[model samples]
Target: MRQLVRAAHIGPSLAVVALATLLAIADGLPAQRVLLVALAVLAGQLSVGWSNDLLDEARDRAVGRSDKPLASDAVARRTVLVACVLAVVAVVALSFACGWAAGAVHLAAVASAWGYNLGVKSTVWSWAPYAFSFGGLVVFVSLADSPPQWPPWWLPVVGALLGVAAHLLNVLPDLDDDERTGVRGLPHRLGARLIPRVAAAVLLAATLLLALGAGIGHPASLVGLAVVVVLTAAVLLGRGRVPFVAAVLIALTDVVLLLAAT
Candidate 1:
């Protein structure tokens, strides 16, 4: 059960939910709408996680990753199926509670994630999943109130860069395993030596944009930029595990930005 839970990557999903909440709050979403948006975002993430486990079960087992719930048989296939169904239902319910526009964003996110897990993850354009997933999230937060607007126009651009970094970093540790399993996506194509550099470059671009976004006036935006700069420097200096730490700092910075914006 522990392995299964970890395989679900629930913690990361929660982080994504928290990030969505920050974006929503920053955009001035009402309390009720914020709650609904959080639920929708979490549900969408759960759907993605569950679907990934299901689709990767064969590969995971082949790699001897018996720690995974599905791989270890700690949880029944039917259980995962039920979970996926419930997650989708939750998304629908929250979407309805939030509004059609919000619901559309959730559905789009779910669709994109599902697409990636099913087959897109093996393609050269695997980064599309991260881009679409984060993009949909930004759109959802942007549309939280009425017409949306909190994040500057450049937010999504920075977000795309962040998405690329996420993809590269995420695949770093799994490169060998992924290659052995024939999951030679974009990250694999980049090769090991270049992947970290790519990640650094993406993080740098995101920080620059974030700084530029804040320079016009919103000082709070600098918080995230600062975190990114420090974290990126750490990673480039051979502190490989620093990305996870940087992720936490980034999340905190986002929260601070939201509070300042509001």
Candidate 2:
């Protein structure tokens, strides 16, 4: 049971729900609608998380990854695999409860994640899942309204770029392990040292685009952008924890701006 919980990647899944809920609240969704959308997001994320651990069980074991419950034999692969299947069902059902268009978009996000686990994670297109999954999320939440409205143009763009940045950061610490396991995504093609800079640059681009798309009168966003620039510069000058810290800082800035813009 403990291992099963661990395999769910609860922290990240909850973060997804939190973000989706924030979007729902920003859009003034009814409490029931917000809950439904949040539930759907949670289920999809659970499927993604479980499937990732199940698919990577062998590779993780190969790399002796103690952090992975499956790799460490703390959870049976079959158990996690079953959870993935069940969560996927919940995702589909709950998504349709939101509406057809919203359901389709959320399902595409979930499918993109499964596609990544099934084969795409090893290809150059590894970034696609993150982009679509995240991009679709805001769209899904926005559409949960009684009369759905299109999300602003900047919403999905920032989401996609953040997705790319996340992919880079996530793969960085595991580059060597992933290489050993025969995983060669875009980050691999870019090499280790360059991944940090690229990730920072993408995040920086997201902030600038958000600020520009929303107009310049908002000094708060401009201040956030400035903070991102400083963090990016610091990351470029150093190594180790700086990149991760910078990513977190930029993400926090993004959350504030995202709520404001949406």
Candidate 3:
């Protein structure tokens, strides 16, 4: 069970779910609706994670990536496959439970991520999935509202920027392994040395959008921008998990400010 859980990429899965939950709350969703959004996002994320592991199983094994449960044979591939299928079903039902608009947006996001897993991750267009998925997440939350309205344009822009940054950062740790297995995404083409700088720049751009889009003159917006700058610096300068942790913090801060602005 633990191995199966590991195979699901639990950390990233939970982070995506948490972002959905926060967006729901920021949108002033009722508790029940918020829970529905969280469940739908969770199911979608689980499916994405599981499928990614399943698809990459051979590559992982080739690279001797023991950290991957499928690569290490810690869990049966069939088990993970079955779980992924279940998650897909649950995501579909739960997302529609929120409403047609919300469901469609959520499903589209899931599909984009699945596209990445299937083969897009190896192409220059790898970043497209993350941009669409993350931007669609913002739209999904808004459409989940009773009236099903769209969010302010800046919100989805910020989300897309963050998504791009996420893609770059995510690939940094696996660049070598991916290269060994013939994977060459946009980040891979950018090379390791430049990816971090690009990621930091992307993150900073999101922060700027949040500040200016939210309300440039607002004292809180200025404070939030300052904090985000500090966090972005940490992402560039920090070692090990520090950069990732700081990136997450920067995201949370931006979301909070965005919510407040809205």
On TM-score, the leading prediction is 2
Q: Each candidate: what lDDT?
A: 0.73, 0.87, 0.89
Candidate 1 TM-score to native: 0.85
Model 1: how far is 56 from its true place, Å? 0.6
Q: In candidate 1, what residue range of length 10 has the lowest lDDT sum?
A: 251-260
Question: Residue 121's C-alpha lDDT in candidate 2?
Answer: 84
Total clashes for model 1: 0
Q: If both were scored by lDDT, which would come out higher, candidate 1 or candidate 3? A: 3
Better of 1 and 3 by TM-score: 3
TM-score of each: 0.85, 0.95, 0.92
Per-residue C-alpha lDDT of model 3 across residues 1-262, encoded as one tens digit per residue: 9999999899989988988888889889999999999999999999999999999999999989999999998999899999999999999999999999899999999999999999999999999999999999999999998988799999988888888988998888899999999999999999876776677778778878888887788888899889988987887888867777777677667767766765
Question: Tens digit of lDDT per residue, candidate 1, span 155-203?
Answer: 7666666677777767777888888899989989998767776777666
Reference-based TM-score, model 3: 0.92
Ranking, TM-score, top scorer first:
2, 3, 1
Flag regions of model 3 displaced more than 4 Å.
Answer: 230-252
Taking all chains together, the TM-score of candidate 2 against the true structure is 0.95
Candidate that beats the other on lDDT, 2 or 3, i.e. the better one: 3
